[model samples]
Target chain A: MRLSLLSDLNEERAARRAAVLVTEVGSGEQRLVREGQVGSDPLAKDLEDSLRQGKSRLAEQDGLQFFLTVQTPPVRVVVIGAVHISQALAPMAKGIDLDVTIIDPRTAFATPERFPDVPVLAEWPDTALPDVGIDPYTAVVALTHDPKIDDPALMAALRSKCFYIGALGSRKTHERRVQRLMASGFTEADLARIHAPIGLDIGAVSPAEIALSILAEIIASLRNERRRSA
Target chain B: MRSTDTDILKAAEAWRREGRGVAIATVVETWGSAPRPVGSHLVIDEDTNFLGSVSGGCVEGAVITEALDVIADGKPRMIEFGVADETAWQVGLSCGGRIKIYVERVD
Candidate 1:
């Protein structure tokens, strides 16, 4: 907990970069490993494992036990449509430790009174997604089936390394939507990333049920991706 | 507020910057019916002020008492707690489980 190390940790946090504070339990010595450096450090493999799981852990290397304190930025859930489903999804996402933001151009739907305590951005996705700053920690969800709104948002999310991208529609609707994206120059692999007919198939009949399914699917995807990389 | 690990770390840093001695207790490992996941944190200041949680409410009192000592002694230690069937009614951890928590001063 030296002043220099504190400054380093704060700087990385300000930059929204992931890092780990490694404390040698025996000696009380410490080191800050930035996300980029985790791949090359002597504890590279262990560090990567910690980062992938997004959990701090005690790692023993050569009989030396070190506490890896993980410092990851907050996970963001950006819902493109401030519709009924979003009304249910936003608060649920926040309940599970995600920062939720709902975006829609329609002021009638995207009202502060409707979504209390949630940031409702009354702007188009093209203008608002950049302002929101999508990153690997973000999960983008398109609740609106409107192609004009959801398409641009999907493109923006796909361009970045956002952890989850989901769009609300039926399987048939997704097939037609896939055709549109393909015509717009998206590859098969890129289009494959979208969780079309978004959410787990839980027989969700109500908006709240659908919202629960979507969040569950997103969490499952996040954990599965970590396992895949780990 | 959110009770996430990041919030615990931020609170620890802020408390230390405000000249309050801080100790952080982290759940290093858990086995069987543990309430909180490994890596969960409970940061306690010199005055017994704390944030976040390591085991829901199963063992905060014991952890906080150890955390106060850790902040004063500047020594780190691993402490283990387990629920036994004989004392299940006496304590809240009716479901049996064991957890190891690492307590250290945030210096």
Candidate 2:
């Protein structure tokens, strides 16, 4: 099949287990173009021709042209701490279609019973990192405050190249952790990647609101990076 | 559309035989009130395309743009969209619910 880069977006969305929306784009003169009819599709171009115009979003189908723009792709959330915030975080993450993976070394917290119908990894950071595969395609969040758990995971995340690596802690905790990481040989640049405190400063008072804060930060990172790249 | 890897390979093999280019798109995530669950897929041919729902037909316009770039540069790109976007309504999904879409082009 002709999976041009445009279509390749669809392909990768599938790889990442993401949902997609293909909208029909046209001017005011053309709006009745139905949804799944190929005849209504604009002259479909392979990725090469598609790249010829990043801003050209005119799809004509059944002789009627539609207009559309490519929105953001789906995101995957890998939470290293499975605490109360996590309980609220999972569904919140799922609300926006993030492929959420909750990891905790504590068996008490990481059981399927606690997080039913979700992907829970009860392994230590080191062991889980490889299995989880921290690719540029994935976002890593270290929620456990335990250095043994969060640090190893952060090290693994830094070693690999995950898009976002957020850690949960207070400003004091962040300072101490920085000292530890600095002594461990991590450079300042590496430390900069960590979104310490792990969320936006919204004065969240509950686990659920904290989850929202974290989700908001992730959203900000994704969009900000997109604008920069664009 | 509903083709498997073997199906894609078979189709790609045919295109390769004909000396044409082939591309692959994989779905990484799906959000609330979505028709297709995450992991659902669709493959596009050089001319004809395959099927399977990704978004509810809202953000594919942008995905196609990047997928083509991946095929041209022979590199991989991670693309995303949905509620998180300020202008997400431009594609009809700017509602509070969001989904992270990653597009990787495999030749």
* Candidate closest to the true structure, highest lDDT: 1
DockQ for the candidates, in order: 0.42, 0.03
TM-score of chain B of each: 0.89, 0.67
lDDT of 2 at A46: 20
Give the lowest summed-lDDT range of ten residues in model 2 chain A.
A26-35
RMSD of each: 2.9, 13.8
Winner by DockQ: 1
Q: Tens digits of per-residue lDDT for model 2 on A162-193?
A: 77889999989999999999999999999999
Model 1 alpha-carbon miss at residue A100, Å: 1.0
Residue range B1-107, candidate 1, lDDT tens digits? 54667766777888888889988888887889889877788989999998999886878887888898988888887878877544333445645788888888877
Off by over 4 Å in 2: A1-12, A17-73, B1-107
Indicate the TM-score of model 2.
Answer: 0.55
Q: Considering the two chains of model 1, state its CAPRI-style docking category.
A: acceptable
